[model samples]
Target: MPDWLSLYYEQPIELTHGEGRHVWDAEGNRYLDFFGGILTTMTAHALPEVTKAIGEQAGRILHTSTLYLSRPMVELAERIAGLSGIPDARVFFTTSGTEANDTALLLATQYRRSNQVLAMRNSYHGRSFSSVGITGNSAWSPTSLSPVQTLYVHGGVRGRGPYAHLGDAEYIAACVADLEDMLGQTAGGVAALIAEPVQGVGGFTMPPDGLYAAFREVLDRHGILWISDEVQTGWGRTGEHFWGWQAHAGNGPPDLLTFAKGIGNGMSVGGVVARAEVMNCLTAHSVSTFGGSPVTMTAALANLTHLLEHDLQGNARRVGGLLAERLRAVTAGLGLVREVRGRGLMIGVELVRPGTDEPSPEAAGLVLEAARERGLLIGRGGTGGVALRIAPPLSLTVAEAEEGAELLGQALHAAQDHMTGRRS
Candidate 1:
């Protein structure tokens, strides 16, 4: 490591190799990988097809501009459009979830012809300038809330889509009203409402049932598009959902659906599925080259084939439910746990102080470290960074998931013991 290079967070142990859910540290210690590359490695580590595809593709063509076009790229786009469960949708490839967010945001702006967006307070979209502006977080960089100021708090409306803009979901409406007021008095027009269908990085938060239905009605009335950021929740990772939006009640679909992670199965690929009407705004626009290489798209195509062939989406639901139930049962006695939330495998264990009611972030870190040392690897999340992110590969076995949960229980108890020893 360079001397001037700042450690982003905790120092990560060097792993020599990984296969399935197990990882071997440089020192030869084995760890069960509950993190699963932040929920990207859906097929698990060192997946056979992924390795073969990479080796074969790397040996072949690597890059070619979209202008020239490529078979694999076009084929993969067709696959995405077809599997995206959207009719007459178009696909635009990108390099990461951030760029996907950027693409969706751009499309939303064009769709509503407005300057505002609506997002939830606990939402986590991405870290780009515009995405961050709509991303509701205090520490999400200074640019997180800088784009529209008061107006950014509201949503856009150009055509019919999802919306209620009232009651509990009313904040989205308040945002809409704010945008309407701002547009009437100032700049005018609201662009879109972008959010994670299931807030993966934001503590695996899930909205109420039928929420999207009401939201859709509202957006339709306002003419603002619904952009679902499925970077972490897409594919079979969330079990029953092929698309994250389906988990919530909604009619029809999102104007733009963003994807990364599972679609690439850890490959550096991301993109957006846009409704033809919304995507039409880009026809006259010039391409600045965000498209993926032939090799990357080939890998994505292979991954998609694998996902459907194995029916991994259904597996995600079955195994994830089994594991979450086990963990929730074991953690039920803990005083430091606030709640265990989220659907499928994208679970979160929110931490709070036992008695004082303040979150015990240090305690959560201790548990995570203890779990790592005891042959399991888990990560943290949430606003205070105290969430135990227990998402594993969608392909993880029921036995493996149970084993991971058991180890996490042991680690939590061990952390509690350490605190007791210190207090005594």
Candidate 2:
């Protein structure tokens, strides 16, 4: 593996198998999986519906590319287009979120006839050359060179930025003003302003609701496209809305949107959705051979069906609320915990140096290690790796949420003691 390849835990355990919310390591120790393989396992591990779909599809045929008629692919696309809420929306499937965002950028740039893009500060899109260029996190984006003339904007991270101390209304005005100023500096019309509804890799950070709606007014005036990168916050994971863009309800929807992560329930499924005009901008033929493979499509169809049939979105709202309350209660008054924020199952617990707001990556690491030892698996995020990411599967039951919270509480206290030299 390359040195840059990221892995969790100082001593990563090899997961052998899993069922529902629990997984067993090579040593046969069971763990309650909170991160869901970086939020890819949407429904549950080894779900019978998804597994059966793959099995049944595999028996018939697998690799019929875009050259032929694909029922499963079309079906999945139709469902996504309808759910996306973009009028006359068109869908294009890819193998990952990176490719999905890349395709959205391609369409936006081509349709607008400009290579310039507007991205949020402290945001992460993906690792592809084009995606990396727009990513605002320096830790992830290794290159300064980019295909598009990318301009980083504010209003993504709320509490730590220049406008953090301002009241909500004042902060919104400041961010909107900053955005107007940034646009004035741009030489030509920007192709699009792409954003993650919740900056996932930037540590589940997000701005006040409707911040994007305010920016939408500016984009609309300049005829610049708004692209919501819902790769992490999509599929009702946020609970309040199916799509993250819906949080900014004043604006109808974005011109373009990208989705991946949980849609396939561990299957490699991703795609871009846009109004017909934007999606059809590509002149030449473009196809992804392995993108809409029957096997993957079947898995996605089944997984999506299960998600809706079970009303897992409601499950996310109810169980996630309980989990959030538990987390806030446990970490309250702790010197190392800065804030507890996030919606639904996508929660982030920001850690700071004891008695200070400065990010404490060391404390976060200790909490992660302690949690793992207690048979729990969580994730870490944020620019400085100071946020504990807690996103369990949407299908998580109330009992599992309670159990995970208790274990996490114990881990946090242990981490606090170790950090303060109470434990040697």
Candidate 3:
């Protein structure tokens, strides 16, 4: 592994296997998995339907390129097109979210004939060259050299920003005005605005409801395309809405939407859904050799079917709501907890120094270590790496939610005690 490849915990354990919301390490210690492999295991681990589909397809065939007409690929594309609200929608599958965002950028820049783009502050799109160009989080973005001249806009993070003190309506207006100012300063026409509905790597932070809707009005005026990067927030993870952009559904859907991470249930499935005109704008020959392989498509189709048939979206709404409430109650009196924010199952507990607003990555690290010692697996992320990110499978039960919350509470208290020099 590269030196930059970061691993969790002071002592990381290798996971051997997982069933539903629980995974066992090589040493045979079972843990309640709260992070869900960075929210990739959407429905559950080792879901029978998805496993069976993968096996059935693999037995038949696996590596038929896009040059061939694969039934599974076409079928999955049809399903996604219908799910995507863009008029005359088209779907193009990639192997990961990075490629999906790259394709979206390709389409947007090609259609608009401009390389200048707009992204949100404290946002994380992906690791690819093009995707990194639009990332606002400095930690993830390794270099300043970028193919696109990305001008970052604001309103992605609600509680921390220049307009954080403003009321909800005022905050929206200020962000919109800032966007207008950015547009005015642009030398030429900008290609698009790419943003995450809820920033995943940026500590799962999000704007108030309808913030994107307000920004959409501004983008529309300048004929700028809107790309909703739903890599983390897609497929009912947010609970309240199937797509995170629906929270800002003042206008219709975005011109393009990129998705990955959960749709394949850890099986490398990603794609971009766009209006026909935008998707068809590419005149040059292009194809993803392993993008929509029959095996992966079959897995995605089965996983998506299970998600819809079981009403996992509704489950996320109900169970995630309960989990969030439990977390808030547990962390209410903790001075190290800066804020507990997020929607549905994608929740973040940002840690700060005791009795101060300063972010405390050390406190977050302690909490993660404590949670692991107690046989609970969560995640940590933020601009300063000071937030605990909790997102279990959509099929997480109420009992599991209660158990995870209790474990997390104990972990929080332990970290607090350690930080205050009262280790026990």
Any idea how many clashes model 2 has? 0
lDDT of 2 by residue, 105-191 (tens): 999999999999999998999999999999998888999999999998888898797899998888888999999999999898899
lDDT (Cα, 0-100) at 186 in candidate 1: 44
- Candidate 3 lDDT over residue span 1-424, tens digit each: 8999999987779999999999999999999999989889999999999999999999999898899999999999999989878889999999999999999999999999999999999999899999998999998999999999999888989988799999999999999999999999989999999999999999999998999999989889899999999999999999999999999989999999999999999899999999999999989998889999999999999999999999999999999999999999999899899899998899999999887999999999999999999999999889889989999999999999999999999999999888888532
Q: What tens-digit string does per-residue lDDT give for candidate 1 at 1-424?
A: 6674422236567878899878898889998888887787777688788778878987987777687868888898888898787779999888889889888887777666676776765566677787777767555545534554323332222111144334545645455455455445645456777778777766676655455656677667767677888898888677777888886545777878999877777788889999788887864655535477777787888878887899888888898899889888878877777777777888888777664457678778888888887889887777667678888887889899889989998888787777656777
Of models 2 and 3, which has the larger lDDT? 3
RMSD to the hidden true structure, all candidates? 4.9, 1.1, 1.2
lDDT winner: 3
Candidate 1: C-alpha lDDT? 0.74
Candidate 3's TM-score reads: 0.99
- Say which prediction, candidate 1 or candidate 2, comes out ahead on lDDT: 2
Cα lDDT for residue 213, candidate 2: 95
- Against the true structure, candidate 2 reaches a TM-score of 0.98
Q: Which ranges in model 2 have alpha carbons more than 4 Å from their true place?
A: 422-424
* Residue ranges of candidate 1 with Cα displaced over 4 Å: 1-11, 144-187, 283-285, 288-290, 420-424
